[model samples]
Target: MKFLLTSGGIMNKSIHDALVGMLGKPIADCNALCIPTAMYGHPWVGPGVKAWEFISGKEENPMVNLGWKSVGVLELTALPSIDENRWKPLIQETDVLLVSGGDALYLCHWMRQSGMADLLLSLNAVYVGMSAGSMVMAPNIGEYFVGWTPPDGSDVTLGLVDFSIFPHLDHEMLPGNTLAAAQRWASGMRGPAYAMDDQTAIKVIDGVVEVVSEGHWKLFKP
Candidate 1:
């Protein structure tokens, strides 16, 4: 039940420390599994093999610096279809699961179909979700931004957490994700929503939620 959800992966010392602390062991002793499946959602261009190259070439990816004994990158979507059993053992052996960002809907597709979403609570490891990774864990993803929409006509609730997370708040790269947009999005929400910038993260452990950040964030309530 340890979750470290961030906009950008480990952007500061606070987030890094929080993640390590959640592990409850020296980070050097732990291992991780990186799932970059979200990168293939809508706007998923090019051949499928190109997507694999992008993930495999992340030798300098940020997930490597968190002090894990090893950070293994495995594109969930690339795995053989209908074979969660083949990868369940690998997932169980890891100390952390780092979900990469791209498109929330795309990520949700692989997680739900792969049965990874159901195995989450039972795993004895930390779940680190960045951007889209954070959104897919919500009970329901309301209309929040221009992209990252859930499937058409489907509630598609992962039910992993009670609230939805709007990541990359005030981030310069995404002009549509301004504070005003977040307010507007939250205004229509059925429940609470959390907005976080790259330097921020929301930590949830055993139902107790905590804000861990080195930048700005907001908790929007309905």
Candidate 2:
């Protein structure tokens, strides 16, 4: 599995290049399987839509521009109501899984409710996350900041990785309080905690993690 988790979309223009560098030219050539969980009802869905189009060579919004196969976008309204069987085809046929940033709590809740949690975790696919998309993949979601709330109860996360992650670290609302909050929150956890500022990313490949881009990343231990 491969991951490109960025600190929000402070520098999205480099995301496609970063992804290509991580996955290599062969895999990068495959269609872009985008999961825009963040902009479900937001007004700025255009960028997410156009990014996929630029990457996959798709002309329309509803179409998937698969270079060899066919590429398409799978818009998820509410995760709880989606059919798992339907995703099998999409997941199996797609080359990459691009997860856009949104509300971390809502995204996690929806993934679990939709029953896509286990399936998504098990797949040996490429994972690309921005902002909230980057946070949900971590163990415990970052402390609520940037208007994204944490899910109630034990809706911690998918635990895809052992660390707790904070995205959009430089946003004014976060600043010093973000890492301080992360340290406090991780006080009882076994794994470490991390925060990546905007325009930065942390790439994990074959169990090895590295911070990419020109920024500072913090890792805290209990």
CA RMSD of each candidate after superposition: 2.8, 5.5
How does each model score on lDDT? 0.77, 0.62
- The residue-by-residue lDDT of candidate 1 on 1-222, one tens digit each, is 688888887888899889889998888899888777886774642236535543454433356555678878766666646476678888888999888776777677778777777788999989988777778888666655335555565545576888888888987768998889888878877788988898998899998999998899999987
List residue ranges in candidate 1 displaced over 4 A: 42-61, 78-82, 146-152
Candidate 1 Cα lDDT to native: 0.77
Please, what are the lDDT tens digits per residue for candidate 2 over residues 16-104?
Answer: 46666765665426766666655442343434664444345453322133232344565555445666677667776666676666566
lDDT of 2 at 189: 55
Task: Work out the TM-score per prediction.
Answer: 0.87, 0.71
Clashes of each: 0, 3
Worst 10 residues of 2 by lDDT: 59-68
